[model samples]
Target: MPLENVHGDPIFTKINKVKKQYEYLTEDIETDVAIVGGGVTGAILGYYFSKANIHAVILEKERIAHGSTSITTSLLQYELDSNARELEEYTTLDNVITSYKLGLKALDEIEQFIKEYGNKCKYEKKDTLLYTSKEYEVKEMKEEYEIRKNAGIDVKYISEENNPFSLDLKAGVYGVNAGAQLDPYEYTHQLLDVSCNMGLKVYENTEVMEIAYGKDEVEIITSFGYKVKAKKVIIATGYNTQRFTKRNFGMKTVTYNIATKPVKSFDGWFNKILIRDNCDPYNYFRTTDDNRIIAGGEDVDFYTNIENEKLAKEKYSILLNRIKNMFPNIKDIEVDYEYCGGFISSQDNLGYIGEDPNHKNLWFCLGYGANGILFAILGGMMLSKLYKNEIDENLKLFKVDRFDK
Candidate 1:
């Protein structure tokens, strides 16, 4: 498959300066593990594998961190795509609680990495608000708050009488220290840089054309016909995994985003909290380190040509007007960037990680859905441990064959 236009003019790519350039595969190579993508998820895998003394190499069809990673909102939160009560229909309530805890653990892992290395990705811990503007949905919001609070999560409930945000909210769940945001592109490079120092090789403009699985090792042939022999193969190629398998992993959609230029003031946007509303095709808002407000989430069904200029204009326009209406007090809301990218969501709102049950040495670390970045963090930790023959119980929750009959 050819490289499709996975993203538009994303804000992260324009704001951050190029830090490093990697060469394409010039000669055949062999390693313990071969990562098939060079985005944030692949970089995270490289970091963990190198730290565990595993020989790993990353292969990218294009430049690193230029695909779906570039367009990510990077709103790190412990919440799933649905409320606990709703998700229970697909997964156990206990599992939902566990996933939330795992998300927090992933957030802490990112913080620890920033502390040890420098904070090159504009990392900041912030609060999150899941609000509902409709009066009828107030009961659902209260149930969500109670579920989180009962799970020992630090959360507060706010109704119309005590709402603190500028938006009219019938009910909301205020998650304290439960979310964070960062520059996904910068963080990808930072992880790759650290991994390179620990003996991880990365190749750009090197697309994997074919893979021949062997009894003990798999041979991956690049577009330039260079071979990579690895004992294990991890597909971290985001939602572009049709060549690797025929199984339908999840529902793919195009999510749009618009970023405003640095505003003079935030007005009534309390703490600039990472805000999401309880709507079917929801919208989320977050403030950048430079004072720009990013609003995303007008999703449409995925199509072969994601670069539909006409639909893009419509979605971007919707997002622009949304931010303006949400924060009327903030003036001069000029859209600095407009972009949309492909996103995937699972039935249970979780990611697929660990080895494929059918393919012997083949693995997948697909962190689909709203919690993608956080799920990728969890993937890095769990997959690395699996390489050391240590089993993380959480792996069952993300089994690649969970949907298989």
Candidate 2:
């Protein structure tokens, strides 16, 4: 599916500082691995593969980081869309805890990368605030808080009196050193730039139309009648993976996002921390380095409608109201940008990683959740290790066949 219209005018892409370019694939090439997307996921996989001394290439249908990556609000957190307390129903408490830890590790991995390569993505480490205003939902908030606290995570439960924000909160969790924000477009470009220097080839405007699996290698046919043969292939095509596999591993949803113009005053905001609520289909908000308030959350089923502007306007209006409801002090909050994007969510609310059970030399790194970028980092590290014959048992937690068990 084409994502040109799917990801609307996101604010990050509008002020992107990094302006790197790449040539499109004009001839057939061979590599140890071929990544089928150029978003942050594929860029991440490319970086890891290069570090592992594997010859890899990234094939992007459009310009790099021009897809859903550009539209990402990039509130990087260790927490998933479903809290640990809710996730334990589908898996073990141990597994849920492990997943949360893995997410934290992924954030560290990103930090390490920035340290080594310089912070070109405006990345910053911040605390995350997960709270609910409704007095009745305080019990569930405390349940989530206890689960993380028991797991040895650095978290504090804040009551109405202790809440830092001006808004009255029944209860909330302030997660320390557990959240971050970044410019996804810039990060993707930076990773790709570093990886390309380390033997990673990238091609833009190269669309893979078909795939042929062989005993030892996989061949991907391009839109312009070119072909790429590789020992393995990683599909990081986001919500469009249904085009290649018939398995119903995830469902798609349409999410609306809006960014406010840079503001002068941020009174009552706690360290400008990432904020989300306990409400269903929750609204999440964070600030950009430029002091623009970026928030999103109204979601609808994507399969029912491809792209609708009238509906998008309605959702945007709802999101704007949500922002005001959360922080009424931010006066004259003029919206600078509004967008819509498609994201996939899994049955267990965890990422799908590792190789497909049915296809040899075919792997998938579908990070389907609110924490997609963090899961992508974990997927890259695990998959690169898998390709190096250093298999980690944790892969079982994110295996594609986990639902079958």
Candidate 3:
């Protein structure tokens, strides 16, 4: 079932139109690989697998890219939701650094894709500012900065005196050319647009009803009473993986955002850097190509049905007030769009991407963090390598059984 729509219109769908659609699956088919979701992760997998000369098809329960992909803030950062220093508590510092580098590589891969194909999405490279208004967080931020700097990452520590923003920041970490922003909806379709010509088959309005695993092949029965046989299956269904596994892998949360009308200027702000704070339930805001400010934060515990219009209004009001407090210069600021949606963060703050331990040839490409898009790219690459019998040592860090006893 599709997740309920909670609030105002998503800003991305407003700016972009769906370019492609597929008829529902009504007949049995066989393929080398079958992808179970049509969100960004599935689209990415479809692109990589198709490019590798592997036959692949995407089965989507609803319209492609209409799920969580549409509501993404699309802030492509190399940093994780849990900073490097914090992640070290869960894994080795070496592993943490490797994950960070992997994020940089994924970001570069996206740039390359845009270069080879065309940038249908509004993609742009930008600096990132991870700042803190609270004095207490300055120490941790500095530690994070030193760790990244020692690991050869381009970063700097800035105090309030040297801060470029009008906001009162006690300290901040300035990541040079470390982030990018784009229209995710357009990116998803653009990927499909390229992959479709490469023999990638995509079908929407197709739901997988049951799965029967075999030693050599996996068979999926769809709601339309059609069978799909594949040597391997990848579930990119985002937070709806309960139908396959029930290990409590995903930590779902409700996040909110408000997009303001295009502003005339960013007068006193820093170089349009992707800005996020160190505060718990931190606030993040960035500017779009058309000059609109999209800011989001104030996450709450997940609720199944978030379609409460009144609650959405209240949430938007709070978000707008926060924006006003941060940028007093954006006078008469009003929200042109507002929305709330569910997203998953993993226990270790890293994404899970590997074959299922109990089921051979059954794989997962769940990118379960704020770096969902980047992790999706990583998953696609790694999974493709795994299928071709190539070793990817990075998979050790994101093993699906990492939390298993």
Candidate 4:
């Protein structure tokens, strides 16, 4: 299947100065593992697999980190799409707590990577505030805060009296050191660069046209008919996984984002905390290394024609107004960048990362929802362990067919 235009003029790609290019596949290659897609997810997988001494090759249909990674907000939160109370309908509270801890573990993994390899990705650990402006939602927000606090998380409950931010808040959950932000484009390249040093091969502009499975190995044919013979295959194609599998994993939608020109000050932003509202179609706000505020939300049903400039303008306008209202005290909140991209969310608002039960030696590392980068980290660690025949109990939480059964 042909790849659709998955993103608009993503901010990260435009601002990223150092563009790294890789050669496309020219001759047939063989590896222990073949990773399809060179975005952040695939890059993370390559990093982990290469670190584990696994012979791996990454094939990207386009440029690396030029897909959904470019448009990602990179707000590393240890929270789910829904709060514990709401997610309890789809999963148990204990499972939700476990997922939160897993998110923190992923955050730690990223920090460790930065410590070992230098923080070139604008990595900064920040607090996260999940708040609600509406009076009716205060109870629900309080319930969420209590659940996290009771579960041994470092969370503080905020009410109208104790609210610290500029935004109107009836209630909020302030998670201390529970989130971080980074430059996704740079992170993807950095990961690939490090992995390449460990003998990870990456091929860009090389689309896999077909896959033929054998009893023990899989053969992937590139668009130019060059082949990749691998013992295992991993699909990290983000939201565009339908071409490889018959499973309908998640609901795909288009999420809009707008970045502001560097404001004079982040006065009322309170440590420039990563802010996420408890609204149905929630909005999230974060700051870049250059002090520009990037806010995104307002999701619509997925459409193939993502280049719809008219629709994009309308969504951008909505996002622009939201930021202005949310921080009216901050002057000159003009939009410096605006973009939209396809996103997916599962029933439990988590990612899928495990081998396909129906297809031998085939695995998926698709990280859906707002915490996709974190999920990708989890996938990289878990899948690498699986390659060594070690079983991670967390894999069951992200099993490919969890919802089906």
User: Whole-model Cα lDDT per candidate?
Assistant: 0.92, 0.87, 0.86, 0.90
lDDT (tens digit, per residue) of candidate 2 on 73-139: 9999998887776776788888888988998999999999999999998999999989989989899
Which residue pairs in candidate 2 have backbone atoms (N, alpha carbon, C) closer than 3 angstroms, thus clashing?
Answer: none
Q: After superposition, how far is residue 64 of candidate 2 from its true place, in Å?
A: 0.7
| Per-residue lDDT over 201-245 for candidate 1, one digit per residue giving the tens place of the 0 to 100 score | 999999999899999999999999999999999999998899899
lDDT per residue, candidate 4, 370-403, as tens digits? 9999999999999999999999998999999998
1-405 per-residue lDDT for model 3 (tens digits): 435533557798777766777889979999999999998889999999988889999999888998888788999888888777677677788887888899999999999999999888999998999988898888988998999999999999999888777888899899998999999888999899899999999999999988999989999999989999999999998888888887577668788888999888886677888988887788788989999999887776776547666766777898888778878776857789887787788766788899788997888888887889999999989888888999698888788889888
On lDDT, the leading prediction is 1
Residue 176 lDDT, candidate 1, scale 0-100:
96
Rank candidates, lDDT, best first. 1, 4, 2, 3
Residue 20, model 1: Cα distance from true site in angstroms? 1.0
Q: Which stretches of candidate 2 lie over 4 Å from their true place?
A: 1-7
Off by over 4 Å in 1: 1-7
